[model samples]
Target: MTMEHGRAAGTTRKPKVVFVLGATATGKSKLAVAIAKRFDGEVVNADKIQVHAGAPVITNKVTEEDMAGVPHHLLGVLPADAEFTAEDFRRKAGRAVARVLAAGRLPVVAGGSNTYIEELVDRDNAAFRERYDALFVWTDAEPEVLDWYVALRVDDMVARGLVNEARAVFVPDDADYTRGVRRAIGLPEMHGYLLAEREGGAGEEELLALLARAVGEIKENTCRLARAQAGKIRRLSGLEGWDVRRVDVTPVFACMKDGGAACHQETWRKLVWEPCQEMVRSFLEAPGCRPCSSIRPARR
Candidate 1:
């Protein structure tokens, strides 16, 4: 049956799902629990870390006492060393959502892992998927070697494309011997430079030295770009209708830590509990918000 947004047949409206996301040390769990209590919702774990088992103390898994009888799914269910991927989370989380709907309860996903949340929402479009894969390849390469290789490839590709006719023809010399043969056969110039640096031959040491300097320059440039982007984000965040706020919950967590619980209760309070509670409360108290008829108490 098609579900209408909090409306009976012939009533016009659509219900919206609620999502709460933030960085670590934000109180997501507490907020989710509180929201669940108020709205008769079931909380779903969206953070990747909270899925591991056997280390609630280390991972700050929610305790029964902390849950206060509210239902939380997908927490402390996996072994710590076991690998869990986004695809795994997506399948499991989708099932959890379906179950919540089947039970006529609100499904609230709360967590700090932005990537996990994005996957839960199925926002992985082709462009993002391609970019994600590219990033994985990029990060796996040695920084200095990768930078030099990338630079050379980009330059060569641009030259081949005839985007710039004035560019010098890339030649593989004895100094560029590392992967010069590969580069000569149409490998990216960047890869060739890296290969030469790594292989180190007669005068390859000089080439390697040049590559090191180039890498340093690249790092500095990258940092500058990041800072500039951050500044832009800050500026844009201050624009109209932006409700961005950064809260420091360190003191609250510190208190929980100093209070001397068996583990990092402060992390739980800050990362899970508080943030979840706030999000729940905000949605519940929003103007025109009403009790969702879809919400039903889960059978114990």
Candidate 2:
């Protein structure tokens, strides 16, 4: 079942699975969709928040109009209050990949959830037993640019009714914020604002102050998450060695909001997608090399 170079028992090789991973607000989802379109692939959601149902604005789910009919899976399927784990994701994602392969379409797994992506990379997982190569595309942005994007996104979320979304989903007694969609970024930070609103008697200025504080906390927390994500990637890279590819996307977001969709798409195609295509192409054409531990020299 293994594919060595271009030959697999003299049969044509299958497309490699592509994993697009990065911190939140790094444009990973956008790139995933575009790559899927270019490569005739389907995007499989790996973000924990995006997996839950009915919180598109809160979770920043890719919109239907924005999807461009590329077909995305595992988005908004789980109940917001339901509990799920990395093992659960592995099982579901395996089934999804199998289905995508059965339909002869490439599977592009994309999200900001590093743990979920790492689980898929684990060889013990069923997804890794299919005898197909996987290409890990790590999307990145400059720290300052990422900060700007996260702040802007938080502001936009507030303008688009994030407060109301928090109000609707907030549970007064639910202190276990680590469970289900509650674990989503930005919710716990809004606790103070929600509490102040429910307590009443606060002036408009005071309410605004509370919201501003919450917004700041959201940005800080997101940056912290990005740092932790980077640490995990570093550890994983050390273990996986040459399997990881990093792509800087700071410029893509720099002009994304200012009517630069077409321009951004072209830039991404040239910088990220094209390089990924070349890497995977090279891998498919090169003779497969076994690990050093698995090699046994012939006896003299």
Best lDDT among the predictions, by candidate number: 2
Off by over 4 Å in 2: 1-9, 12-15, 123-130, 254-266, 277-300
Model 1: how far is 283 from its true place, Å?
5.4
Q: Number of clashing residue pairs in every model?
A: 23, 0
Winning candidate number (TM-score): 2
Give the alpha carbon lDDT tens digit for every residue of 1-300 in model 1: 223213345644333345544333234566667656666778788767677654343234667998999888888787544567788887787788667756766666766555665565534453222321100000011234333433443344433442121113333453341231211212232344555544666285777665555444434443343334334324433443222233333444444436545344655455435553454344433423322332211111
lDDT of 1: 0.46
Question: On residues 1-300, what C-alpha lDDT tens digit does candidate 2 reach at each position?
Answer: 123322446665654677877778877888788777766778999988789886577788999987999899999998887877887888898789778877767788998788887776674644473456776667777777778778888888888988888888887775568877788777899998888888898988999899899889987998888878766765665554226667777767776755477987777667666765565445445534331221111111
Query: How many residue pairs in model 1 have overlapping backbones?
Result: 23
How do the predictions measure up, each by TM-score? 0.44, 0.84
Candidate lDDT (C-alpha), each: 0.46, 0.74
